[model samples]
Target: MAALSAAEQTVDTEHFSESMHSLSSDAEAFPADSAEQHDFVVDFIEKEVGSDLKSLKNVSNLLKKLTDENNVLEEQVLTVSSSVPPKVSAALSAAEEARCSLEELLKKERLISNMLHQHLQGAQPWMDNLGQILNQVDHIERHMEYLRCLQHIEELSAAVQQCLMTSSVWEAIRAVDSMAALDTGLSQSACSHLQDFLRETLHFWHKIIKDRLTIDFEKVLTQLHWPIISPPTQSLTPTASSPEISSQLELLVTQLLALQTSDDLLSQKDLASGKGGPSAQTVSLATPTSLAPPLCLPIQIMLLPLSKRFRYHFFGNRQTNTPNKPEWYLTQALMWMGNSTTFMEEKIQPILDRAGADISARVELCRGLLSLVQEKVASDASRLLYDDALFSHLVEEVLQFEKELRSNHSYPAALPGLLHLLLEDAVLQKWLTVERKMAVEKMDAMLSAEGAWSSQYKDISDMDELKAPDCAETFMTLLQVITERYRALPCPSAQLKFLGLQRELVDDFRIRLTQVMKEESRCPLGARYCAILNAVNYISTILSDWGDNVFFLQLQQAAVSLGDDVVLRDLGVLELGRLASLEGSLFEGLLALLDRLKGDMLGRLLEWTMREVIEKARPYGQDRWLSLPSQHDLSTMTLSSSACPMMLCVRDRLLHLHQSLSLSLFQLAWQGLADRLNKFLYQDVRRENPQKHCLCFYDLSPTSLNV
Candidate 1:
């Protein structure tokens, strides 16, 4: 609007200039032309001035209208311009605030982005750990499905207990079967607690069922008057209650057989699949003999009367309960077994046969009775071991009982009899210790006896036999008895243990001989010394012979089973490896003893013969012996009959040794004496120069010196 107003003003100014220029042109044209020009100009002005005046009037009106309009437009422009600054300032301030707010928002967005980045970095490991945990969970979920049966386990447990308590045999068995199946299935669970809970529940059920069966079976057995003490006669007949008792016994046996079969089948399945879990492994570890068989409980129940009787007669303070006669109780136990086992085999075995239970009632009966007997014997032996006589009787009776069980009754080897208890490592160790101690005591007593070292060569009935002193012969006999008693032991460890004990005894004997040798008077050629030498030789010969015995040889190759290395080492088996022959220990000890004897005999011979003989022979050596004696003179002039004191001493010593020692030992002693005497005569009796020596030079020939 302002530019339009300015354009209108410029057009009006241009028109006014054009009009003034026209008037000036007209004036110039009319210049200086007197009256005519003035007249012409006045005419022209009158005509044009009239039209211009009218036109100028119209223009003045138009200019006035334009001036008014321009004034109104300028006022309106001033009003708008005046208000626009404050409004623009308000707008600019508002824009500035919006910009600041945008900057703050950007800063906050950047900060949040950085925090998020840091969080992501820290959470990387967490994510990885979560992934691993999820994988483990997945794996557990795969195996945990097997334990799903646990939800009903408490219910099954209650059901089994209820059935057992109510004497619902079939229902109880079925419930037990369900629990067993659950146990077998859940054994593969990865949860240890679940497996433990399931197994505990299953085992409790088994125990409950077993107890119920035992109670019912005992009732049946009592009703039948089972395990009758006396022998059954050929004309014996059944009683009115026999059919009911037999039927009840059959049902009890059937239930037991079913449970046993379940255990067996579970074991076989685990083995067949080659998969063992805690339950399967536990079941597999149980053996019929190690633990009681299914029939063992009833068998024990049947033997209750017999056991009571035996305990009454033997275990109490009765006359028959004497410790001196363990065989009394042992015989009674055997008789009970003989009486009961036949009846069981004839009557109870048919029940098993009818039930298809593959177990021997006879064997189980004997095992039960023998178990009672073993328990009694072990109890008695524990106290009796402190008494030598009682202990010996106990051991003897136990052996006799074992022999009867194996030989007379044809006892099953699978079932451990009295010997197993007797041959336990601890028990066997006690027995070995007792034997060793007793042997040592006996050996000491015999060695200290008045005539213990006297040579029994002449006293023996057989002249051709080699003879030793009483102690040596007795020791050999004791050793033979010990060997015979333990030689038939089935356990290699027991056999090796006994063999090791024997070896220790041999070494101990050697030590005793050494002590005796040291205690004896310095008389190497005396009767006692000769007897010792003969004893050493005799024991050595016996040990050497026994070392090669088949029993010992087999023991050497036998591996030490259930034997303690420390105990075995104490027994001298450690010097030999586990499988090495233990006979070497005995042989080594005897050889050492023999060497000591030889050296002692030689040293004593030299000591005694050279004690005063050298000084006495000084006079003899001064005598001349330029001429040698004849052969007949030499033959008659044996040292035994020689009158020279040196010859007399040698003759007396050698004669004594010959009379006392066995022939072989005498030869050994003689050879040692000959060598020693030869050295002595050459070195001590004779002068350094042969020409200076005289008296017995020719008399010192081997034949003249021989006894």
Candidate 2:
């Protein structure tokens, strides 16, 4: 068996070697051979190594097992080599895909992180701003609540104080300080309600104050006992006051006396220091103390509460236990006249005197006197003849005083009072009529030569340029006085007489104006003449209404005739175009007259005057007039043995007329003159020259032409 085994081993070895060769030579071609060879190797090993032979059999079993294990390993290797490579490739691909996905996911996460960072970056500022805005809203609401609480408390305190002061519930306000103290604790809602309540309360209080004032004023009026003159006396009446109250009053009086003394000292010091001089630092500082009294007694009287006892004593029914009495105001006036005469005479009269006894002073004095008169008239006592007599005497005395002061120009202050007094009294009106006549005569004489009107005219003539002075303002003042005086008289005859006088005055004025116009026409240039004409026209226009009276109409006609002569002179200059160079003065006169005349009258009069001027100027041809040389040639050229001055006078009269009636009239009259000239040329053998137009006279003989 060993030998056989050896031989088999050699054969097995050879087969194994041959199989190894074939496997090495062609690994792919041996699929059947490889399996068979693997099985054969296993079978040979199992056969050669029988189980009986212990060590050898164990070696053969181990070799055979090792060969079987090798074959299984080979199969596993082949399967692993083929499947594992594909599986490994798929795993590698999947792993690569997963890595790529992870990379993409990381990139997406990075992108999302960047967007979140950007969003957070944008949101941070807004969040911070919102936080700041919310903080401010919390602050404003706190202050509003504080103001509302203060107003409510003020109203409550006022109501409580008002109830405490007077039993009648309508007393003067006493404790405003207490009311103001309550303003701190009030809420907003309470304050609004309190404000409304307080407004209504204030209105109520204001009405009460007014009623009280009226009652006091009425009581003052009732206490005056008119028509009864009495001397001043200081009588001490018993007072119902405790000793302490009396002591307090005494102390108050002492303090008031001290204050008065101090005030007097200060006033004296101020007067001595010349603080009220014209050169003082301020206007108030310059005001004289005498002009404005230190004590305002009238206003103080108005402020005092109504005296109930005085009202009961005076205004009560006469049939009852109450005594009949006069008005308090009259009584007060009497008392003031007696006791405060020094105040009125020393302080008030000095102011009135310094006011220059002018119309304004008179007006103020009249007002004060009238107030006293009203109080006297309102008194319940019987009317006193002495009072009426005293008023009349005062009126007469003031009038006489004014008259005496008139020459000194010191009565202007008194004139207003005089006028008012004249209006107030019928007797004064009658007195004024006689006085006015005397005044009128005196005024007429003064105004005749040295008065404002004549002086003004004389002054105007003395000026470099002769102009009619503006007498309108002075005339207006005269008219105002005359009108007022005429109105004061109740008689229609007197008014008619005044109207007649006014008409006469206006006629005289018109005559003077006409004379002025005529005199002005003698001026070489029409400028001064035209200006005077305009003044005349202005005066004529103002007095035109006077012409409505038949008597005045005749005067106006004469004046108009004189004006016509002036107008004629102005027209002559205008025709020569001399007035055009006169600085528009001639045209100004005509325009003034045209404006003054009513439209219809102006049109008609202007047309008539223009026609007259045109007709008169027709005989003097333009060429003949143009050929006449200026004043320089007057001595050398005696164009005609004619009175040149007379001709000049006529020419000047016509020129004046033309200028006084404005150039507008001439322009209207010359409207168709150009066309008429063209027609005349066409009929009269007029030919147009190349350089200049020429006219050929066909019907002219040498003798007829005087050539």
Candidate 3:
């Protein structure tokens, strides 16, 4: 309006200026309450315009008269009237002054706007940030509302309690749920109030449902003396209508989950869990046989603590920070599973695993576990139900069960329920897959041509390192590391499966040994024996750890049998050679190896040696192989007694063996071997297949077999 008034002033004065006749319209458009000033301006304008108008009329009459008279007279009249109206000239001059002032104001305003634009450029970023801050602040009121509501938790708790007391369950549920909608930690005072509220809620609900369930539970303990698992509520399926679940147990769990409690209150629930009643009567169980063990408690008593644990872990106040959006019912449905697992492993499994545990007890325990599991994890037909806890429990049960069975040196009963439980859980499937992978890994580690350098893999040389973690390892050697690893492994049934895999590896190792022995070279035979000894000892040593696992016992027996077969099959050559290389001696029983060699490789080698002796003697022109002259020299035949050092070594070894053995075992074993060889030499080498010469053993053997 100022700019417009200023522009109007400038235009009125500098451009086609308006006459005073429009002043009345201008006054009305620009009204003011200054009556004195208005009257003054009106008087001044009337006085100024009055004379001008009188002069103009006189001039106009004079011009008309003059025009009628003469043109010169008209010009003179107009000049005289213009001079007579000086006040009107003063008013025109004031309007010109106002226009000039407005022009100055416009120039100053332009200058100020230009300066502000420069500063505004620098301030744009701050302005933009301020805008964003204002937008974010829009939620401040809502956050304050939530905080205010949080402060009122005590009041809300009171309201809920009142609602519950009045039997307005829906109102109580709404009140509690509204409290749940908030996600904030409470002050200690408020938290205590909340815990009080939660306790009241629990007390109220328990007041309604306790008597009914207590009676049922007490009757169950008194009569059946076992867990009376409620039939599972059908999980949410499209075709199936919801099962009517008014059972006191379900109601107790359901209502308890709807409130808020402190961590301490959550830990304190026993009466609601059915433990306040009298303890179940214990029956005297018949003592188990030597093979089977007995459990520590009867089934009802065993499940009692578990029942309490489940009630404690599950059926709690909906936590303050817990998510409130998910389908809470399905969560409540699956809630017992995790509690059941903790209860079974911590409370029940130990009893079943105790010494002298009876099968009947295990059966009852399994039944309880299965029933509890089915009731919680399997009962839900809801699509949203997740039973990961179920798989973890079943895995622990099967693994621990097998471990107990193996430890007691007893077998397990067929549990079709366990199989079905495992079969339904995809987690169990994945667990089995991981177990299989570990088994394969162990076997590959065993069979790999390369040795394990790190402690992670088995190294035959690092027996102590291998034995380090093998606390319960029964194996006397490096194999105990594997047993320990498998035992510590998390996969269900992995220890037994891994032991079976070791057995397969052992079979493969034996086959490899057989293939190696088929080679004709003797030099490679020594290295082969070393490899065999190392491999067999590596396994056999670990298999000695029967304290933890019974399966290692089987491997130990197999390893011993393999050792015996390899030693006797080689006729103590490999064994004696190995012991000799290591600067060790054979035991007294190794002399028996000589007997095992008869009619085998050692017999053929012996027959070939006698023929070589006969031929060497002929070349010596000593048709004298019958007996070495006590003074005979081997120089002529390039051998003493015409026998190779290997033969003489064998001969000397036999002599030593005979000297060491008493007459009985030595004759029963190697004496027969020597007699058969001598018979072959005398009958076949001397008469039939060799030159007729007296082949003599007097230099190396006893008189009876010297031939």
Winner by TM-score: 1
Which lDDT tens digits does candidate 3 get at residues 1-707? 98996665565443222433355456666678455556776686455435443333333344356367776767789988888789788999999999999999999999999999989999999999999998789778766755665566656667767875786765666565554433223324444555455455545543433333344444433332223233324432322221222133234323333332321132234323443343211111111123222222234444665566544543344342122222232233233332333334433345344423333434445444434433333222122224433433434544444344334322244432223333344543454454445444554554443432112223443343322112112212324444543453433343444454444444543454334434522432132322332333334333333322434433333333444333223345565454434332222122223223222333333344445444443433433544445425443333443445435544654564343322333344365546655665456545653544434343333354643
- Using lDDT as the yardstick, the better of models 1 and 2 is 1
TM-score, ranked from best to worst: 1, 3, 2
Ranking by lDDT: 1, 3, 2
The models' CA-based lDDT, in order, is: 0.69, 0.41, 0.42
**Candidate 1, poorest ten consecutive residues by summed lDDT:** 279-288
Compared with the true structure, what per-residue lDDT tens digits does model 1 show for residues 330-366?
8887787777765787678898888766778888877
For model 1, what is the alpha-carbon lDDT of residue 378?
A: 65
- Mark the regions of model 2 whose C-alpha exceeds 4 Å error after superposition: 1-432, 435-443, 450-476, 483-536, 541-707
Best by lDDT: 1
Instruction: Give the runs in model 3 whose Cα sits over 4 Å from its true position.
Output: 1-398, 401-437, 448-524, 530-623, 626-641, 644-647, 651-680, 683-693, 696-707
